[model samples]
Target: MEKDTYKTLAAPGEETLFKEKNSKFFGYAYPVNSEDEVKAVLEELRKQHNQARHWCYAWQLGTEHIQYRANDDGEPNNSAGMPIYGQIQSFDVTNVLVVVVRYFGGVKLGVGGLISAYRTSAQMALEASEIIEKTIDVHFTLQFGYQNMNKVMRVIKEKNLDIVSQKMEMDCEIVVATRKNNAPTVLEALQNLYEIEVKTS
Candidate 1:
């Protein structure tokens, strides 16, 4: 069966802190839907942590066809970004951005240490977040005459479909939404009605 639900952060997670050999890693998790949002959040963090040595980050977007990016931001290649991204995958979340800002403490943490620290920081940030599951909805546009309005309303009421928009006139039109799993059933039900036009939007 195809999956129709996804997990995502409900809001910005609480800031987190991790330390290794006197080096500081400040972690943050934010809900993001696009690259623009990711860039905006990174810009804000850079301003907030102006003195930080490095700002490494990772973000995952989309639900089914997933897209993601990992940036070391001057940290050793694959040491910072991939580890942080690993935490995001372990948590099974999308549409989220995790960032780790570091302040050098005069001691160099080798690549292995850096990976562990970044992974821990990302995990901590996600742990502090409120994760929520949401259904993937499919929208359909419905067109019918006034005489068929009652039939359409009955199906909508019976199926508990959400009405995104509706226009009532000589020719009525409505935009309805239903969970992806139930879309076929809902579409069939509406199409069965006489003279009612149901098209996936």
Candidate 2:
């Protein structure tokens, strides 16, 4: 069976801080849906931490069809961004952005040290977030006449579907949403009704 649920952050996580060899790493996590949102958050953080030496970050955008990106931001390749991304994967969260801003403290940590610091900072950020599971939903449009309202409503109620919208004129139209796993059953029930047209939307 295909999985129909995903975990994500409810809101921006509280800022996290980690220090190693006098270098400061500031970590932040935010719920985001698009690359644009990710970019905007990075822009805001750069402004907020103008004196920071590096802004390494990672983001995962989708649930089923996953999309992700990691930026080293001048750190050694795979030292900053990939470690942060690994933390995201370990936490099993999507639609989330993790950023670790570094303040150089007159010391240069080697690749291994940098990786450990970035990974720990990212993990702390995720731990501070409120993770929640959400169902992947499928939408369907049901079209019928007023005469078939009762039949349509019965199926919706029986299946515990959510009514996204409805127009109850003589020609009735309803938009309903159900969990992706239950969509086939809901579609079949609606299609079984006479004179009712159902289409996935």
Candidate 3:
């Protein structure tokens, strides 16, 4: 069976730039998992761009991408944050963040201009980034006596399970990571071994 996977920014911390009407927009992209990670990235940007006029951002999390937020940061409503989020959706990426810092240049860009500027700046940053495919994973601990170890090992080998850790002796324990979507099949096969012990951690 195929495992579940999704597209996301390769890693955190890519900087790109876009300018309009002498206003410099510095866009930063980050691969984030939790809200805490997003906050850390935002805080880092705030410290780095303390003089900037606006710090707008958008983030999407989880495979379902049910959690997300767009912050305009003093920019006109629907101008800054939404546009950045639009680009994230456009890229079809989740578990990612884009923040654009605007250095005002005395010229006031109206709503339309602000939207376009933010959108384009964020898009540029995303374009400069390397997107990657990631799989949802589950971890489990498998234990058995030496007598039944071969049965468990054979099943693990057949499934190509990732060994997170292993302790092999008279009694053996193996910690494995595998795609979350494949867990049911793998777990069922492992459990079929009558004398083996399987536990998820």
Candidate 4:
């Protein structure tokens, strides 16, 4: 069965350096949710490692890990990017990006060597970083009158749902995030309140 939650890098950046056959490979891992963030991080890496020979990378997005990419940056096909991505899959984590920057050391490592180096470098980065588990959340918008605030709050407290945001004016509105697995139960309970309006976001 597919999991309701997943593991990903907890923080933004982690680095690992591997030297093989006199070639230097610097690996960097980052937590990201969108492609724009991926571009931003790659651009930043370019700025930081301006003199590197290749900027190979791989990224997986979303809990399902369906959206992903691998770029070899000029290295032989499957020698660099795919190996780096293999490490990501091996870790069984998503919503993360790993970039490996290669600095030519006057020693030419063949395809096999390149793959080993990239994979090891990527693994080193993940091993050094913190991994975090993230639950899949379903968002909801709740609208109700102030008179029902107590009732709604009581249910929220009982469920321990995360109140993403709330407004407490004449027309009270609250946005909440519930674990995807618990959404049905929570929605059923909320429906019992006739006056309160609930909509999934």
RMSD of each: 1.8, 1.7, 2.4, 1.4
Better of 1 and 4 by TM-score: 4
Tens digit per residue, CA lDDT, model 4, 121-160: 9999889889999898988899999999999998899989
Model 1 lDDT tens row, 111-172: 99999999999999999999999888899999988988889999999999999999998999
Better model by lDDT, 2 or 3? Answer: 2
| Model 1 regions more than 4 Å off | 167-172
How displaced is residue 78 in candidate 4, in Å? 1.6
By lDDT, the candidates rank as 2, 1, 4, 3
Compose the digit string of candidate 2's lDDT tens values, residues 1-201: 799999999999999999999999999999999999999999999999999999999999988789999999999999999999999999999999999999999888999999999999999999999999999999999999999999999999999999999998889999999999999888899889999999898
Q: lDDT of candidate 4 vs native?
A: 0.91
Deviating ranges (above 4 Å) for candidate 3: 1-3, 143-148, 166-173
> What TM-score would every model get versus the actual structure?
0.91, 0.91, 0.87, 0.95
Model 2 CA deviation exceeding 4 Å by range: 167-172
**lDDT string, candidate 3, 1-201, tens digits:** 564888898776568889899999999888988999999988888999999989999999988536999999999899999999999999988999999999999999999999999999999989988999988888889888989877887988999999999999888999988898889999998889988889987
The lDDT of model 2 is: 0.96
